[model samples]
Target: MPRTNLNDILIFMAVVDAGSFIAGGEALGLSRSAAGKAVIRLEDRLGARLLNRTTRTLSLTDEGRVFYDRGLQILASVDEAEASVAGQSGMPRGILRLTAPDAFGRLVILPLLEEYLRAWPDIQVEMSFTDRVADIVEEGFDLAIRIGATASDTRLVSRAIAAYRTRLCATPSYLAERGEPRDIADLAAHDCLIFASRTRRHGWRFRGKGSSWIKAQGRSRLRLDSGEAIRDAALAGLGIALLPDFLVADDLAAGRLRHVLPDLETDDAKIIMLYPDKHLLEPRIHRFVDLMVEALGRERPDARSSP
Candidate 1:
């Protein structure tokens, strides 16, 4: 059988990645009609309907998904071949897809991403900032940054990037009104802001007088899914909150919130990076991971400083 045009496959993949024929064509400097025709030709050659298209959206059929995965492997091989020839001089070019927790993405990752973009002129990034844990492989994300989460999937590689101390805090008014919790048992009487989500609820745990740890028996009257929202609720004097230092350091330094039970020790909120477990990582993936490790492998002195 005659071979299918490789350019058609590239165009189809581009369209899927861009999520629209027009945008995909624009990426390759082709007209929408031309890109659409290329995809149709490829589909005809393969004798399969690849994409389910509507007026405003596009999604892959099962065959398209499989084909796309194979295409990714093919591209990886091509990239590896090019890198072998070019060695260290090879420039990283392609879209880097990333997902990170909402508040942390805005507060921390965005700055690093800005630097990454500056360092690599040919690279582009697509980001999803959400608290919801995403299936990195299924979602086609190159990397995911998570807080206090673990990867259970055997197909993913998880690396711990940083750890931040957590503090139980409340506004002065709330503390004054409710009285400060002198002991862990007192938490039962105070209103606590809990981090609850559809998948799981975050519970506060602290080291006891001995080596044992105990869960805080706080009365959770308000539950929020966002770390920043919990901080806001604490600032509003609604309740006491358990939050990472990075998110509430300024509030504590500015006297907006007071730390509760300063002597008590809490578990650190670990920052982890997750990606597919590929033997040979693309330059974009390895380079970004290296950047993250270099920047956040250890706690930076400025991480807790008030801005």
Candidate 2:
């Protein structure tokens, strides 16, 4: 068998990552015909078909999946080797893979990405936004921005970027129609928007001056997976929603949504930066994480500051 070129492996990785030849070609700056031909050459050398192509979609064959899993490792090694040699110039280059929560990614990270892109034109980024927890090490991600507590992984490192807390809120119209709940027990009679079914069963918990408590029962009107959906429901006067305060801060300030049981505290979830545990942080990943922290510093509330 002929030795495979790095360019061919790169093309295969791009196709798997993008899940479309046309999109991969656009990303890699190759013509569709050229990209297809490169894959064909790669498969020819390997003596196995890598992709099952269709008019509308692309799928990885059994061998293709195996190659993809291994290909990422090969590419990562190449990237690291290049970075090591390129260290002489002291500038970070190559693509940085990152992940973040859906709504947070859309509202916060997307705005800041342009700055990173402009500051280091040579360094590219592939950002994935999803609510699902990602295995940074296994997925070959350089970094991940997560809310709530960071996951426990021996192969990963975590740093708190900012401290944030959740709040209970409802549209003024909703409150006007349903009246305010003065205490947790009052929630049993009111419509509350819940994020998880578990939250519905367990209820809300809070701690504050002169009180530490939990509310185990509420009349749930809607259960949503997205934070934005809960906030919107509250704004639309559908029900009271317990959501991250950062998400509804503008609404609270604009008088569209009113804070409920202000004296009774709610759960606090920290925003954190998670990355692979490494002996020496690659200059690119280090700089990217630092830039993200700085950007968060500017956007977070004064009350949410953490050392």
lDDT on C-alpha atoms for all candidate structures: 0.87, 0.77
- TM-score of predicted structure 2: 0.71
lDDT of 2 by residue, 161-235 (tens): 776778889988888899999988888888988765322222567774477566537888687766787788888
Instruction: Tell me, by TM-score, which candidate is best.
Output: 1
Clashes of each: 0, 0
What residue pairs are clashing in model 2?
none
* TM-score versus the correct structure, for each prediction: 0.74, 0.71
The lDDT, on a scale of 0 to 1, for candidate 1 is 0.87
Each prediction's RMSD over C-alphas, in Å, is: 6.3, 5.9
Clashes of 2: 0
